[model samples]
Target: MSIISLSSGVQNNLSIMPRWPATQVLIDSLAWQKLQAVQASLPGHLGLILTRAYEPRVSELGRARTAFRRAGICLFGLLYRHRKEEIQDIFGSNGHDLDGTHIDVSFSINGQRVRLLPLSVFTPMSWQARRIKKFDEELSMVLAALLAQGFQLHRNATESLQIHCDLKPVL
Candidate 1:
């Protein structure tokens, strides 16, 4: 079990509400950290970063399923929950509570939804256009996978969504 903490600046800045990019960096950093932790913990199998969705599709909704299958990683998705007690019950046999780790995001893509379980799962390591400037074959694969399924990334709802990751080690 690992402890996840948002920097005070990140926690407090949210009080005033910074711009999207600023908040994004914080989320990305935490996501990256958790990914690293999982990677280190489980040497061979790829770590699944599960997060919450409004009403997630048939698990691994986007092209991520095939991609994860090909890469040999598991992807889990679940509905969003706010309270710590409520979230505590959703854990897989693999892990628990995610140490209360959650990523709040405004779902950006249209006809698009990724079901990441354990309350929140992430696929954004590819979804962000800037990641190319910063990092994947990931985004393209996710998009292509979705396109193959006939889903388009048109602009849609602006509802604030939470992306959570369950640090459950899975093979």
Candidate 2:
């Protein structure tokens, strides 16, 4: 399989994004455990990336990087700063909801943007719900896997959380 990669600059931009305000519940704990399980189950040759709306806890990032490294899977993190104006621009004037969950980051590979929709917003079943708690890490892995499968970020749409991408077959 072709290896997927992001430019160093994009990665850096993600690293500096502001983290979301703390929640009363420890939602990330479950997601982190799930990520660890997924990492453990992935093929030896597969790589992993952990993306989030904001920068991750240093310990979490360290653990992910170390675990993936030992398994010979490349790992990285992507984060973005959340901006209310940007959300208004994209989701329209009355887009804010009582739920704090919102788009805080965008991932670009080779100058292309990847479309990301909340799995919950699109799917009906609660099981299909996109866990906003794990949005960052989940997005990271999805983007990484897509890149590994030979896709690149395409564009950011004017309105909506969707990010578009171009896919190319591995030579």
Alpha-carbon TM-score of each model against the true structure = 0.21, 0.23
Per-residue alpha-carbon lDDT of model 2 for 55-129, expressed as tens digits? 223546435533533442111111113332243233221211211112233443333443344331222223223
Which segments of candidate 2 are over 4 A away from where they belong? 1-134, 157-163, 169-171
lDDT of each: 0.28, 0.33
Best by lDDT: 2
Q: What does the lDDT read for residue 48 in candidate 1? A: 24
lDDT of 2: 0.33
Which digits, one per residue and each the tens of the lDDT, describe model 1 over residues 24-113?
Answer: 122333433543443344323222222321111233332343343333222223322222233222222111112222332221122233
Q: How many backbone clashes does candidate 2 have?
A: 13
Q: Assess the local accuracy of residue 75 in candidate 2 as a C-alpha lDDT between 0 and 100.
A: 15
